[model samples]
Target: MADVRLFPRLAAVHARRLLANPGISTGVDPDALRSAAEPFVTWAPSGGRRSTNAELDRLRDNIRAVAAACGWPGPAGQVSRASFDAGMGAFLLESGYLPVAEALRDDVWSWIAIALVPDVCLWRFEGAAPERFLGGRRNTLQRLWSRARVFDRGPGEEDRWELLDRLTEDAMVQITERPSIGADPKLAAAIGEAWVRTAAEVGASAMEALTREAVRNLRITNEVLCFGALGDADLAAAVGEHFQRAAAATASQTGQASG
Candidate 1:
């Protein structure tokens, strides 16, 4: 766990300007991007440390190495989504919390996506919005770091990994973005398992509707309930009830439509 620092702040205006440029967005040579981005970065004074130019380069190298070891068979573009998820998840787990936290910042991640790994960004997010390079949620490295932070529930948690593997990309994004459940590991796992079970019991069409409804209901419940006070079983039961209601509603809708 190295002491991490904040990346020098790039004003929102400047950041948008950079992202709007066709050369940066369309993908330029990594060296050229780095040189262009260098002037905008200022290392933090203390508390956290900024990633240096050399450190960013090392990170890129490490990403490639990990991809290779994980049998990703890259050029980055060729890596399967599942393989990329697993490999990046493993990388984030090994990266420790501090670096991951720093990487979460839009400034740092923007630099990484736009300057360091633009090719990977373009490849992985082809035809996607520019936000893929500029936004925290869509940034390639930031999203992986976020996924690892939320789902990699630590030692003796192989079951968590399995649950994660079972999730659709849409499901993963949904669960990860929900602050009410995403911030709590127990809640996240319980909700995930419950969602999977509900999907199994009702099938995919119902599951999508159920998931959407359940998440909406849960968000409302979260406002009034102190979910943290509930034990694991209770929390799980609470989540299950939401899904059960959603399933029932979805079934009714389907029946009426068929009728």
Candidate 2:
């Protein structure tokens, strides 16, 4: 691995100032922002060859293009928000720079959120919580990257990323928000695949309940058993069974409510 760039731990106060800065207008000039933030950014600590300004500019240009395609700065983002999020996640993860260790650095993410793509962050969140701007649990891009990493079906599969677009927000949360389930990409993907299958069988109405139940069961199973030992097909089957049971439980509850 090589060293990557890291931005300082910018406080919420400063984050608010720049994110709310009206003078910059719709989008930001990466070079100008880079110059302003350069005094604070460093490359000594993280992995991957030292990040260059040129590499960073290329990344910025790619992300900007992706946003444009998704209709950023327009009403299209309102309707295609998920698409944009998934696209950004895929691009960031696939972009060659972020290794696991470097990817975990909140400073790096903060820099990206604060200086590199403040324009997108502001427009996307539209005055959401501070964590969305910072690099922690709810940080916009970080969370999306985590989710994309978890749900990605891996190389060689024709539609590997299909799960990224298929699962509902709530369904994604069931796997992603909980550390017990989200930490393991293989397990997460297995559960995601089961969720899609279960949705097809039981319909959308039961999915939310089924997802909750399935995740609950998986958490318990993970505590007692080694999920890592299981083969992909076996793991998917096991998760599918949990979802089946969840579907039954939800159906019974619905029947009781009707009665």
Candidate 3:
């Protein structure tokens, strides 16, 4: 993934744009955006990851420190559904438009993926994965379990998450739409329900399942002009065929270029 300090760049550009066009609302609460960006610039952990008997354990401790400061429970064994949902809501409400804004700033899809994970984990783990580190079972923790598989091998910061790589130009534009401000809340809820049901059955974390489902649903809905018809089996097949064809063409182009 590209090194994208999305908030910094957006701050400068948006600030200038606001000055010149005061009437144009960013659709982002300005103060919330600033607060979200603060961690990116100022929250570097000192003495970074160190060589210890259990590397994952150390990482978990680091995360717990962060979660504790954010008023989350300190142990995975202590997590409950209600606590998890509350933290998730708080993070989501506080998140404002930083995720979209950052994605726009980076001009890369990865920023959105990076931004979403921590917030998603707020709900997915309810603040417990950190404690899993102590058990040497960090691989079973929701965020880590899902994310670790994304990196088969890596150059540290290189993102191996192909799903994120597939978020096309148009998808990002549509996703970054001011959903919080004007999108039908029912649609979002339905999407979330569809995601949780489908994902959990497949042993996917909510974030992983939702991200994939959201992208797939968005592409199909946009192409068919009918999110309303996602349940229509015939229309879904047609939209799926469209996705397959596009994927094939992209693969062919890449092969030809490489050849």
Candidate 4:
């Protein structure tokens, strides 16, 4: 993979317009969209240190090849989230962290989703929300990169992708998007382990309810606690306590409702 570079910041304006076009959201001719996007993309200094149009094409081709290899079929074809996640994870690892991180800007992602690989975006997102084209925690490429970065535990560790396998999509998104969790691998894994256990013990629906509460508790706890300063063991212990409390509260609510 080539080093990823960013387009000029002003390109974001044009990128947004392209994304806003309804035709692109449903699906557009990839070649046509690429042509439109070409004008807005301005490579960085040092002879396009940021990504070039050609690089974007290469990246899209690479994703398609990986998807095909992994059997992650497109919209008209059968699709598996597990296959897609695994394939994308491998791609991210190969792409290297620095270049991928540098290209994570909203504008860059926007251009890529709108022009480079809108089909993949539609396939992954089911052609629903515009966030797939725009930028956010839920942006297709951004989400994939963020998930891989957060859960990667290095060699000889548990496969972090299992978190995606276990958690509900909403749960995974909530957990992965938070700064405290997403930015720290150990912390994310710790919480993810706890969440998986909780889900297995209490069922997915109850676990999701508990997870919402846990997210709220995390926000409040972070106000006084320096989670970044804590070690893995300490963070896990803290999250464990919160999980227990949330689980208990969820159980109590369920009991009351049933009664």
Candidate 5:
């Protein structure tokens, strides 16, 4: 993947305003939007040799295909939404279409969300916050990319991305909302895997409590501990222990101990 072309912040803001315009529910035509977006595309700092917009086609087509199974947008079913997210996450990470460094830019993501696949974003989020359409942590696509990159089980494992499907949105929010855990892939995956195992053992009812406690505990511990320095087994064990303790506390509070 070469350097990415960015859509200007001004264009992203204008695109967001379009959502309020009546009849936006029908969705914007991607080709037309792409043509309109051309003037706003920026190559400041020389975006490395006349980049092509072919990836935009792939993104638009993938949105239709993925959204089709998910009830064609307009607030799809939860299961389908999650499935769609996982599919897109895999696409972003595996498609070889974007460089990781370039993908990190909020404006580049804004272009994709607004100009490339506004229909899908509008369909998925509907009346949700503006950030979902813009970029940054809450952007619909950016979060999925983060999830896939963070939870991938790595090269040697079969179905390396299984962890992405395992996480529920609430559990994810607890991790992603806190920069201490979400920014570090190894740490985030450790916490995610630990959350999954602990939730299973403690039952789903305790998951909310377990994650809350675990995130809080980890945040404080991370100030003194360097989880990044640990080996895989050690990291998992540490994360697992933290979750177990959180689960135990939750069980005690609710009077439903797993052990």
Candidate 6:
């Protein structure tokens, strides 16, 4: 892991008003900074300024369109990327946008992130062993290692694909709870209930425990980045366990207070 720690002090959001126009940088809310830095990251291939705050509604519409095209249910709330891999693969096969290998690679990472943040049950590959399944559910978190293709790489080509899968449901809750991202409030409430129940099962608190868990996970992520062990595929998984624990704890506290 890298020596970088994920603490509020270490992660400061720095706004830049110097460029003919103002911008942000790699401090304080680094993700926000990264959002601003996207231009610099892709400066060479770009010819125009990026669009402003894209907003949640647009993202929602896009998701809905994609979902509908794939025969997914209307009004996407929290669909499993892994479970729908077969449909996606079939869709890709029909579309033929890129090479088969590249398409597969992209699909694997995309689904992994979906699995990490939201609960997912990966579909099985054809002709695989039967025992490697959870009631017909294959390529699950427990059986992630069984699917080596997701992480395999040639020399000099880093294998960060494995980072997409997290072992908790916090990521899913986080997405569902986001107020700006077209989240369903009703689903959020249900998620809160589930979170509280899970937290109570482990006896957790909302204050120090939940926040501290976030802090620790960020630190661990910083360590991973610093050591050059970080890969895009695995970037979000570091906070998986911490997010689940914290969300559960907070949900539990909120539930008790409301009750």
Which tens-of-lDDT digit does each residue in 8-99 have in candidate 5? 33256655664455554555676666566666666436554444556557556876787777777555777878888877787778775666
CA lDDT for candidate 3: 0.34
lDDT score, candidate 1, position 18: 63
Q: Arrange candidates, best TM-score first.
A: 5, 2, 4, 1, 3, 6
Order of candidate numbers by lDDT, starting with the best: 5, 2, 4, 1, 3, 6
Local distance difference test, each candidate: 0.69, 0.74, 0.34, 0.70, 0.75, 0.32
Per-residue lDDT of candidate 6, residues 1-259 (tens digit): 3222110110011112111122211112323433443343211123223322343224234433444564444322334444333233333233333233322332232222221211111122222222222111232322232222222222354422222232123433243324421133232222333334444555534433464455444445444454124343343343345557666666787789899
Which predicted model would earn the best lDDT? Answer: 5
Better of 2 and 5 by lDDT: 5
Candidate 6: Cα lDDT at 137: 20
Show model 6 residue runs off by greater than 4 Å. Answer: 1-86, 90-241
Query: On residues 1-259, what C-alpha lDDT tens digit does candidate 4 reach at each position?
Result: 5644555432557867776677865656878877877777754555336655576567788887766765545443433665676558656664673365455667656766777777777777675477777666667776777776666656566664676556666777668777766766666677777888788878887787899898789878878987777887888889888898999999999999999
Candidate 5 or 3, higher lDDT: 5
Better of 2 and 3 by TM-score: 2
Best by TM-score: 5
Off by over 4 Å in 5: 1-27, 256-259
**On a 0 to 100 scale, what is the lDDT of residue 69 in model 5?**
70
Q: Model 4 — which ten-residue stretch has the worst lDDT?
A: 70-79
lDDT of 3 by residue, 111-219 (tens): 1212222332333343323322121212112222222222122334443332223332233223323343114333333333333334344334323433444455455
- Per-residue lDDT tens digits for candidate 2, residues 1-259, read 4355543444445555555655445556645664666556555453336656677666667877878888876765545777887787777776655666667777667777777776777666765455776777578788888887787767777886778777887888888878887778888888888988888888877798778888998899899987878998888788888888888999999999999
- Residue pairs in clash, model 2: 2-47, 2-48, 2-49, 3-47, 3-48
Task: After superposing candidate 1 on the true structure, give the runs of residues whose Cα lies further than 4 Å from its correct spot.
Answer: 1-11, 48-54, 65-79, 97-101, 179-186, 203-206
- State in Å the error of residue 40, model 6: 30
Q: Over 4 Å off in model 3, which ranges?
A: 1-88, 91-184, 205-214, 228-259
Off by over 4 Å in 4: 1-10, 47-55, 69-86, 179-186
